[model samples]
Target: MRLSTTQGLGDEPPETNAASSVRKKPDGAKKVNIGEWIDGRYIIEERIGAGGFGTVWKAVESKREEFVAVKEVRHKWLNSPKMLNYFKNEFKVLERLSHESTVCPIDLVRGNGTYLIIMEYLCGGSLSQRLRHSEPLEISTALLITVRMLDVLKACSRLKIIHRDIKPSNILFADKSFEQPKLGDFGLACFKSELLALSPRAIGSEIAGTLTYMSPEQLNGKKLSVKTDIYSLGMTLYKMLTGRLFFDPELLSRAGIKRAILRPFREHPGRYRPDLPYWLDELVMNMISVEPRKRPGDPQAVLDVIERNS
Candidate 1:
């Protein structure tokens, strides 16, 4: 159930408030009992969300009756000695991030063989669901979402963290109580200096994110910077506005995907939504430009441009 912002903030409804107090089964991993309490604090509740790497659960702190989100990294995947180290390293990176719009880790727990991260429990579902099922949101609503997300990216940039993946699915919307959107899932996030200084071995090469939202430089396996994320955000905004992707229909084939990446934005915009404002269209075009350098210098600059147009 999604909470509406119109209900006003700070009042937890009786139903959800009651359920929030009850512990239930956690979502995702099958081999273990996810509802089991970790470190005798967070009591695993029902599964709330999932992603490629792990599942997120609504959990309650038994001692304080406080609610939180628990992200569990699958034990099987983490058992690999190398992967375990990488998982631990990622946690360290997350610890360095502190932002209201970005989901922050509250606690870390290491179980028999798995690792769990405790985070703030957001009542609303993901932005991806809102975009996919709901009617096309008003341009103002879309801009509000974009501005909040940019706030998150700006905070991450201050700490030199580059969120390689920045799509609708990774952004969670809080119910009216929290009111603001929160950016989640930092598993693929990398430090700017570390990414720049990496040797081939250190990079541990692989295509790491969703292909539909990938930046051209990312597709080519080049080292990424903040601009790569800007490109993705631009694509996301385009999809949100038009309710369609910016790719060619023929691009699903092996040869076509490469060709579509090189396709110009002008050839595609008219096909989706011709009525989009010229300035907004131009901003998106600049964002998904084939050259990363051609994209906005930073997420803040993108937000500034949108706000100026607003």
Candidate 2:
């Protein structure tokens, strides 16, 4: 689909986050400007978000007259064959899971010294933006978002895929109305088998996810289960209800984060929004319980509660 470059911080795919997370250096890739044509089909509209690995640009599909987001690999990574393969592999994972809540892949192009992935352009700005400007979202709004997200999580679970990163920034709305909650950015997702084989000693040595929403088990690198996602979703729910993070960003060190996770989590959604009913308050708490066993692993169970509350 061809699309124009709409205003606002467009939905950022996982590659954008990956690019910025890597060492800050010039991303050595060919750059294209506005009005430039790509593959003689899509025309570059504007640079919406930056990714060192694959910079995302808004483009218009000339044939279809629709909007699409294109991600182009940077120059420095061309020699590394693995990067290209990695991009293709992750896209395949996303490309397979088709659903209304998931981002749609339009095209994957192999240009000279670069790779480009075209995705559905999301214009409604992310849930993060909602919290940034106005948080503690309406009770009904939060519940609606949670219910829809539960479906997306269930879809991923059925395929044995674990989206390691499930944060507000990754939850996007299709339009400014914020009625549709679409999940994007699967850069850190993994198949269930990938973690099941990891030995205990290797678990904590390398974990990939946002620390703020990471569950204690994930932070400690224990055998990941569906509960890993439960904790992150609960954390997302908390932010939506209270407009705050479970832990302060200052707790970035390994020891500091571990201690925070192990400590008793005293906060609850009801604490901030006194108007919240007891069931929802309890639901959020149970989902984010420090112990993996305490968190409900069933997405439908959580969805039921959210629907009831909504």
Candidate 3:
């Protein structure tokens, strides 16, 4: 199940698999309700969200009454000693990044063969949810979202980090009251400098991100750089403003995606939102160019163009 950040705390639907559900408590013992406590400090209030890699829970600090989001990655997956080390190392990388537009990771904890990542809890839903239920945002609102997202990309660039996966689902709203956007889901994030130095022969065949949002280079299993993320953000902007999938999911096989990217913008310009400005259409087309070099050089440049148009 997808985990969404919303304003205010509320209980979610109960899990039906009571037999398989296991809770880890403060004393490092396993219990039926695993959400009770972990490492003797965190009191798991409830399960907030779950994904393929792990589950995120809303937990309270038993002594401080502080609320935090805890992500639990199963020990079995991290048992590969090398994998565990890499996971811990990422926490250090996250700590170096500080930006208003990025959802920060607070700390990392380990207990009873489980690794838990503590993070600040935001109260707004994801950009994906916003786009799904609401009408297309005004140009000004869309620009605001884009600009904030750019800010996030800029910060990551400064740290030599690349968010391999960039999409609407990963861009989170801060809170219902704020209406500001923050970048989330750093699980696939990597330091460009580090990744580049590693031998490609060691990498596995497993694709690292959502299919629809992947850049052509990503789909081809080619080496990626910051430009890869720019292409994604460009596609995200197009989808958010147009209220339609930029490319047909049914036709999203690698070759089809490449061809779609190579096509002229004029062909699909009016398919989603007929009245959209021609300049905006051109901007998105350039952003999603199949050739990474053809896309915007950086997020700042994209934001500058968007702000001026808005």
Candidate 4:
């Protein structure tokens, strides 16, 4: 039997990257409908998410009698031979990585025009939802989640793969208990070139991250290193621990927002919630430093700090 999360909080569908689905087109998002069977094995159940990059549906793989998430890319992207190849390359990269704290890829399929990526389904909803509805999480709880995500980043770093996007929304709970936080939208940045070449709307929300979490180096178009993800990770932990956003991009114009991210670091987690620990303030603020060299050298370095502080 398949295990499921008991979300006592109501059975809200856990979300992946709906915005990572597809580009807009005259034909619309996708051609599938509820109750339809595709690939001759997986049966579509319902529309779960839709974004600038792609669309996602809840489905059941008849062969395994198990639930799965089907991600779709529209034909508009396929029409571009360049994008089509990039999609294929990205799939290959995602297919190779096997990490427990990351959403696992199942299969990739090519439809009449759309392409579909099948992945394991989770039920506990996303960290973004938790942040949106609940008060600040306990410091211990926030640390636990951060440590697990650091574990994921350590594994990714081994392969020199940078998770360009690290935000509350891309973090998934394996169950309603909310303990197992697996990174979602993995390997979506294998096509960072595509993202840099396209606008946020065209590349989708999940591949990169919102302007608020971006590192100063990323904005400046400097070559990225592990520190890029660390900057966003710091931002995510700040939100979790304080139940607040670090910077409100909406309040600033495009250039203003860029300048804010580029500004020297002057605040820490404790600034918002005085009860936060000194160790936490030191670790997080270091990660959020404007210069990549000022951040932790790697996920392992940050993990070591957590161990020492804890």
Candidate 5:
């Protein structure tokens, strides 16, 4: 369930590159209709969000009086071998992770040839929704939310789980007050151990991630590491600071995409929000650096950089 605002193809600009052109084609993933029930356990209430890959439903659990978020991959993709692997990978990764700032899967149920994952429901909505309705968040407030996410990434680093997708919509508030933001959606996560097992074969070459926030390595389908997630988080931070996309989505050429991913931005974050510290501009720039080695060593380092500047 990729809730990131960038996931929509309607927002994608005219595509010149043949590679990106294919993105416009129908994915053939079956859509879960509203009011549907799965395995006689989760009664789908409403579709809270959706993306190119899956749809998320706010559901009620039978025999239990609590609300839960059930994420199900598209039925068509479930039948595809490669897509099936990634879907199962999410379940495997989520089961191993337990963190307050990271949403972990509570249960996995399969019926009718589709997989459903149940998770604790967070009602405050996504950061993307908040950013869409309200004015740009105060710098302090954005930083506070970012710091919490950094803590989650720090934990992921320790566990060798790299969350390839990090964008505004994937960040959810734990309650109505919008104080606690937990990172959700592990569908694109890659464990270092799994990569090691594949060794020199190079983990499957399916390009994953939303366009704007996707890192260079992710775009190229190169060998990835923790730094891949750092690059994405950096882009998410860019949105938190500016309340806008870091790049112009209008250009879809290879050069345009490469420039956006591999080249440093000609504009600075401070240009959007003057109140931000000068160090922050550099910190964010480093996070989105073209080279993985140039980014922070780990999420802890990112936290330290923010601390020193704050």
Candidate 6:
């Protein structure tokens, strides 16, 4: 990756470079001008969103004549070695995973110290946006979405990939039709073998996922497995069904969170929407069980239970 010199950005631009091609923001970050070509292929369009890791942009691949989503690692975050590793690891995981419900990366490119990950562009926004814009989802729609996610989980289990972060933002509709949901953002995902390699540090290492959707083990920084994803999935389902988080943010102290998580959860799907089937409530209850052992062993089992009960 060529590092472009834009001053105080730790990179030196070419000695004879023309100023017209690069535009620097006030914050010292270089912004890709709309219509500018990246890596001689993708044309920058508009920035879509940003998160802890980086900014995402909607771009077009001129040669392929297709629209794509490009995620760029922030210049500030690139200073951390761990963050760099995470960025590369996300590329690896995305390259390895491909399923109907999983949004996998198509390419990773670097230019002037900028790392960009190209992904399939989804016209419909994230599940989080959907939830925020509307009332609680209908039970049928929620179930369909959850079932498809479960299928993705089952595929992940077979592939030995554990998505450490499973939340609403990572779940996206493939298009405006909203018929296909694709799970993206794998920066926190790690292979099961990698977790085993890091077992010594797993117990007390810093947590690496969203707290609101974290599994108990994840919040505690314990060795993770597929069950971790299941717990988050349960939380995601709860929000979809209730349009509210199960745990109140006010009760986030160590003891408070532990107590709330450990205690048998009493709220059911029917509590929010009386029309939902009791079976859904039962499935979610089993999934959100505080003990990892208590949750369904895998997404396959969860799907089977759903089918048998429905």
TM-scores of all candidate predictions against the true structure:
0.79, 0.81, 0.79, 0.83, 0.82, 0.83
lDDT of 6: 0.74
Clashes in model 1: which pairs?
none
Taking all chains together, the TM-score of candidate 2 against the true structure is 0.81
Put down candidate 6 lDDT per residue, 5-65, tens digits, no spaces.
Answer: 2211223222321123223322433545566677677787888997766678898988989
Would you list the clashing residue pairs of candidate 5? none
In candidate 6, stretches whose alpha carbon ends up further than 4 angstroms from where it belongs are 1-33, 196-207, 250-259, 262-266
Encode model 3's per-residue lDDT on 26-72: one tens digit a residue.
23312213456655666778777765345678888778888878776
Instruction: Please provide, for model 1 over 172-266, each residue's C-alpha lDDT reduced to its tens digit, 9 standing for 90 to 100.
Output: 87785325877877777787876653332232333156566777777676778788888878777777777766764443874466567766543
- C-alpha lDDT of candidate 5 relative to the true structure: 0.71
User: Highest lDDT: which candidate?
Assistant: 6
User: Clashes in candidate 4: how many?
Assistant: 8
Ranking by lDDT: 6, 4, 2, 5, 3, 1
Residues 31-149, candidate 2: write the lDDT tens digits: 55678777777888988775324567888998999998877655444454544454665577688788799888876665433567778999898898889954688878888888888
Off by over 4 Å in 5: 1-33, 196-207, 250-255
lDDT, model 5, position 61: 77
Quality of model 4 by C-alpha lDDT = 0.72
Error of 5 at 265 (Å): 4.2
RMSD of each: 10.2, 6.0, 7.2, 7.1, 7.3, 6.9
Each candidate: what lDDT?
0.66, 0.71, 0.66, 0.72, 0.71, 0.74
User: Candidate 3 — what's its lDDT?
Assistant: 0.66
lDDT by residue (68-105, candidate 5, tens digit) is 89787654455455555677677677777778887867
The lowest-lDDT stretch of 10 consecutive residues in candidate 5 is: 3-12
